[model samples]
Target chain A: MSGTVGLVLVSHSPDLAAGLRELLRQVAGDAVAVTVAGGDDDGGLGTSYELIRDAIAEAGSGAGVIVLPDLGSSVLTAKALLEDHPNPQVRLVDAPFVEGAVAAAVIAATGADLDTVADAAEEAWHARKL
Target chain B: MPESSELTVVLPAHLHARPAGQIVVTAARFTSTVEIVYGAKVANARGVLALLALGATAGETVTVRATGDDAPAAAEAVATALRTTS
Candidate 1:
């Protein structure tokens, strides 16, 4: 099966990822798939990677994943997951949790290409247009 | 997927960086997707920068919408959370 776009949202607070998903649904809806991991009270960095990885794995083949992080270990954790999975198609874009979440949601819903989805996320972050 | 429910909230206080962070946290809770829309502008509910860009202030009405299998529940929860007085 060809790789599909998957959303892996990691945030300092699990609520952040949940919120992003809710927001993304507003525009995008069910066209895309999302897996969320994080928001543990412990605030440990190591756990982030595990959660992201697990989410991606659950998404399975044809679901290329994009990660959205809140802050503090978000980027680090995402990088680590990418290293472990090493899927050329699965990308861990450096997008703010909210921006990336929305972008991914929209792209996935519309069936946009992986690169295009990432670009949309980056634009959303930079646009910062509320 | 278009959401079946939508709600408008006038945040109790200015939605600043910290609150934006809170909003992001809220968005992350559900499987559905959410967005923050203002007049002629929209921001990702999960993106802190985008929410801040909206420049929402105390008492500013912002529309938050959600869609998915759990769209209705998610929308109610978000609206309740956002509308709460800080």
Candidate 2:
């Protein structure tokens, strides 16, 4: 595992997360680690703790992990999980999901560190045009 | 000193995600601070979302500017990416 920062996207819909993952892969190739925690245990519209937990574990590629949750309770579920198993390297970012992931992935693929990845994601929301 | 280059977007469908990604990849290869300017919008060239949002379509000229040690090469590479998809 390289020292590049990885990303975990938490969305309520499985397909949404998958599509976004595909998009990121197209851009960053295999340079950045991007995993998704979408849908519930039943594969319906919801967030799953197991999915989120496993995703972070899988995506925590030595350097750091940044988790971006979709909306509403998805955020809550991710927050609750993080509160219990907090690692300073694992960051839960509040930014626009698609834009943030794109920015984060691009920067991470450049071999940027944790803070640079987080800053890129956070800055994405402001850089987005209408 | 800052270096700058300009080119027309030849990619079909304008500055979408894929072409934007190509531009980002090129811009990331240098130590320079790179930017893409289209109309009133100036986007950080290393950022995919910002470049896509610049909204430059085919035939529309965009400028690639950079400031750093490798500014000239950085600006040229980004402009080439805009002119032809990789």
Candidate 3:
């Protein structure tokens, strides 16, 4: 069994989430489980509780799961989903969408623990774009 | 022991998230303190954010330094990873 943690990216645009997943796959390779939950069932630009919940379940590999949300409602939706399911192994990180996903995915691919992976995601805030 | 080497960034994608993440992952494999230096900025090689912040693009040159019991191996690993990233 793999001890590597998984990642879930939540965004208002399905394309944004899918793009991030693809980028992360390139960085972390197939060793890390990356799943995306974006847009509503109708493919509109909005968050859905069901989509987030399903992503959480799919991304978890029995080690742990870290969720990165893009903006306002996506974070709220993930929070609500966690409130309903309440898994201790899951974390919703408040960080930049793209940077955090890449950072977290790399850390997770290294087989770091949940908190370490979340910290790596949060560290993305310190990244300088200059 | 502290060891250092200079390697040119040959990746077409430069030090973007993918290659930078790969460098960070490789650097983390060692017990040494790895640092990548580009121009005036130096980044902790073990952190993807710091690595990406270095802004070392393709065709640019970067210095990789490591310090610890495994500095030699760590430096070699980091330099090789950067040199071979495509």
Candidate 4:
């Protein structure tokens, strides 16, 4: 549990992030902590800075934390938070939302390191859904 | 020694997300290096996205190969995981 890398999924739509989190839990099991920060403060379909910051703080353990943002603004929000308060254990990976989270979760379930988890998520960009 | 198995995917959706995750979990159980070979693509069995990207479908054949001290067991275990992926 301590060795498992945690994941924070940031999305504009709350359902999208929550759904992906559920799927990740099912695929990777609950051994790896999978958290989500979705929607804006007003309950609209947009990214929220506070939500992302809180989720990252919640998901970050001593082992490591990998954050996957679903949209342009989501990425911006996450990056802003990271730039404001740098955390060495946290990294934002550019990967396809669903595939990337799935990849990261599965590897994190195996207690892989942060670098390995990030690589797995980034590798998901090449996941062909044909 | 290295071991291998040519398995016909029985899963309804081929190696979709769930089934691929199953393979990843099973392959992670052994110390061997597990690979699934389909056409010219060879993916590490522990990689869900890579396994899904193999584009292998149901009724198609994929070779499961494992190399390490526990290669034979790893191969057999992954083969079984592939076959029972419904």
Displacement of residue A81 (Cα, Å) in model 4 is 0.6
Give the top-scoring candidate (DockQ). Answer: 3
Off by over 4 Å in 2: B1-13
Per-model CA lDDT versus the true structure: 0.68, 0.85, 0.86, 0.86
lDDT, residue A57, model 4: 84
TM-score of 4: 0.89
Candidate 2 structure quality by residue, lDDT tens digits, A1-130 = 4668999999999999999999999877787889999899999999999999999999987889999999998899999999999899999998899999988888888888898889989988787475
True contacts kept of each: 0.26, 0.55, 0.74, 0.69
Task: Please say which candidate is ahead in lDDT: 1 or 4.
Answer: 4
Task: Give each candidate's interface RMSD in Å.
Answer: 8.4, 1.5, 1.3, 1.6
Please give the lDDT score at residue B65 for candidate 1. 81
Write down the lDDT that model 2 would get: 0.85
DockQ of 1: 0.13
lDDT of 1 at A43: 53
- Ranking of all candidate structures by their DockQ, best first: 3, 4, 2, 1
Q: Is candidate 1 or candidate 4 better by DockQ?
A: 4
**Candidate 1, A69-126: lDDT as tens digits:** 6677877777877786688777877766675666556555545568877776777656
Q: What is the TM-score of chain B in candidate 3?
A: 0.85
Q: Rank the candidates by TM-score, best first.
A: 3, 2, 4, 1
Off by over 4 Å in 4: B1-13
- Per-residue lDDT of candidate 4, residues A8-125 (tens digit): 9999999999999999987888888888899999878998889988898889887889999997899998999999989789999999998889999999887789999999999877
Go through the candidates in order and give the clash count of each. 39, 0, 0, 0
